[model samples]
Target: MATMQECPRSPEAKLGMRVEDLWDIQEAQLSPTEKLNACFESIPVSAFPLPSSNQEVEIKSDATLSEAVKILAHHNILSAPVVNVDAPEDASWIDRYIGIVEFAGIVVWILHQSEPASPKSPSTPTSATAIAAAANGNTFALELEALGLGSASTTSGNFFEDLTSSELYKNTKVRDISGTFRWAPFLALERSNSFLTMLLLLSKYKMKSVPVVDLGAGRIDNIITQAAVIHMVAECAGLQWFENWGTKKLSDVGLPLVSPKQIIKVYEDEPVLQAFKVMRKEKVGGVPVIKSGSNTPVGNISLRDVQFLLTAPEIYHDYRAITVKDFMTAVSSYLEKNKTAFSMSCEFVTCKMDCTVKELIQLLDREKIHRVYVVDNNGDLEGLISLRDIISRLVDEPRGYFGDFFDGVLPLPANSRV
Candidate 1:
């Protein structure tokens, strides 16, 4: 909401006063949120991951699914726009966007296709059976030194070979698995909208990123992601902001409350496909595992675990038959080989229910993750928190508590740059 007048003017116009002095004078006129929003809006979309003209990363609908995964991995992205270059000559500009392709969508499509024409039910245990199995102490116990703790299984080497050599994956088109954005209303932001508005959109929809549209041309301008938002707050804001936010507990800051019934989870004995079912249904990146008869969380599995598909296509060939435990171990083995700090056992970062907002932010920043599970004093999973949830809640705080920073302040013009 800041205007040119609110920014530091040139030295010639300020006479003997320095630009720093003028900036401080103008900065005093806005609230903390507005000042932060102005700081964010000042940044350009091109500086981050703008995919409009990039050919290497941007994909067409006809590209093979394997090709798509390779591109995403090469660029280190989770999704991208599925552009349609062969639009009808008579088609309107708005109809040209087509849809989006995400890793989750690809997983869903592949799983759907992997089903047998007359599928045999997987030996996945039901909730009751799983609990019984756990009580019998027959459940797989993780050991730090064993293959179960994320070490790649020496027995599964053939699994990868079978997958990459399969004809099913080689001929499958990316378009077949891509989700139509129109179904979700294709959430797009105007290039002119403030970064605060962008944050609200992503948080409201639980999206990792949203496309920025050049509304006039009906074309995507860029994609803004949660990572970009974190970058803005961390690099643009000063230490005073963090200290100020630290004093407040997470409960006071309006994160969605966590309840046992609402927590999406998987049994330790279930087929790995069940975990994917939970993720597809809930649109979540991960799910916690709970032992039968216990309220305490034991482990977690996520889409990141599925990234092994890009390198070890064999993982996909056996994914439907693979148990969640087996998949986690394979991913762990892969990460160890790549020298990443994460372990399937160590990746489930958690915080106590009473932790401060500042504490949550710090953990996320240090780990470079999007969320943390909030647990009670007894170590029971209570809720989940994400970077987007934190940013949205902070920005949406009631303005009454800040007194009248908006008083006597003129609204910035609609076309204002900064």
Candidate 2:
């Protein structure tokens, strides 16, 4: 584990010399990974591609959860900033936005709304035959519009309509769930902040996305995501520094940070709701679906995959009874039928332990996936690697590189997920 290092003030500290200068002088003495880190540190947030507009998909604080889902889907975003409608035009960006409401957070909310008063397992058998039969009439594929790949069928979604507490999603406002566990604190990066600072926040701090706020203009100029960072790293494929580090095998980099016993996964026989609840509790974006009574990974389920469940008609017919097997079967069936609409995410990316870092990066970038599972010769999942995990290994925050830069930021809870 890396700790924040303290650098005592020297006469040079009073000279207003930024760490980037010190880094440049020491660049020759640095390792491949450190050189790559310094390369990014030299860049500024302004260098990133700016969005068309900050107001592109701004959701009102008063908007219903259902309305929020529609807006996110329409814009093909996993999350959007929830701004305070009553904030004065002169209010600071901090006061203007409540927090980013994400697809994952909303999935947890749906699971909460569907919770039964008396907990009991459904009688439906989770066998393959049963699940296959249930998926027959389904026309929905793993709609990944949240990534702007394409549009999903505007099917008459029955997720909200099927819920007994239908009004929960229909009437509940986005602000009402501010107290939920998944509600992340609204933290933004200034355009002048170093790329290293943003990298630390995304990896070490576990922030899925960091909103880049332009204080001078008082608008969110861009939202830097882990995916964006991964893409940036991918673009450095031929660079000497990235090539030196990327050639190392996964084992050398200590990836799949967790052991097989530590992997959090769900069985195919378990209810689809249970799989989501497990993801919510674990604070993970996704989990591999294991075959019933075995360790074989049959499929992958993620929070973003909720679009298929919510938008698909047959999938949500029995929210409580739908098994992970049924869900995976439905996704496979739908994607096979509507191949173009289905993104590469419909299939999980897997690699052996001997896979090189560059190979892993290629898998993630080419597939546009946030994670990849490491499997054995027999194809049984041994561990997992996420975009966050990959970036965390690439750089180590230097001592005093950022002196009290994030001091006044809101304290994130131990279990906060974004």
Question: TM-scores for all candidates?
Answer: 0.67, 0.78
- The numbered model that scores best in lDDT is 2
Please write out the lDDT profile of model 1 over residues 114-221, one tens digit for every residue.
222232433322333343234324322111112121212222444445444444446567654434222234556666655545665666546677777776666677
**Looking at candidate 2, what is the lDDT of residue 181?**
45
Please state the error at residue 82 of candidate 2 in Å. Answer: 0.9
Candidate 2, 121: how far from true, in Å?
A: 17
Question: How far out, in Å, is residue 409 in model 2?
Answer: 2.5
**In candidate 1, residue 370 scores what lDDT?**
70
Give the Cα RMSD of candidate 1: 12.5
The sequence of per-residue lDDT tens digits that candidate 2 reaches over residues 1-418 is 0111124242222111233234446547778668657766776776665443444568899998778888876666778888899999988888888888876787675444333323353332233223322332221111111121111122122432443234445666888666454555678898888777888989998888888888976767789888877776665554445666889999899898977898899988777667777888787888999888888898889988877654454645544445787778777776687666545467877899999999998889888888888899998889999999998998888878778877787765543333
Query: Candidate 2: which stretches are off by over 4 Å?
Result: 1-26, 51-55, 113-161, 316-320, 336-344, 412-418
For candidate 1, report its TM-score: 0.67
| lDDT on C-alpha atoms for all candidate structures | 0.56, 0.69
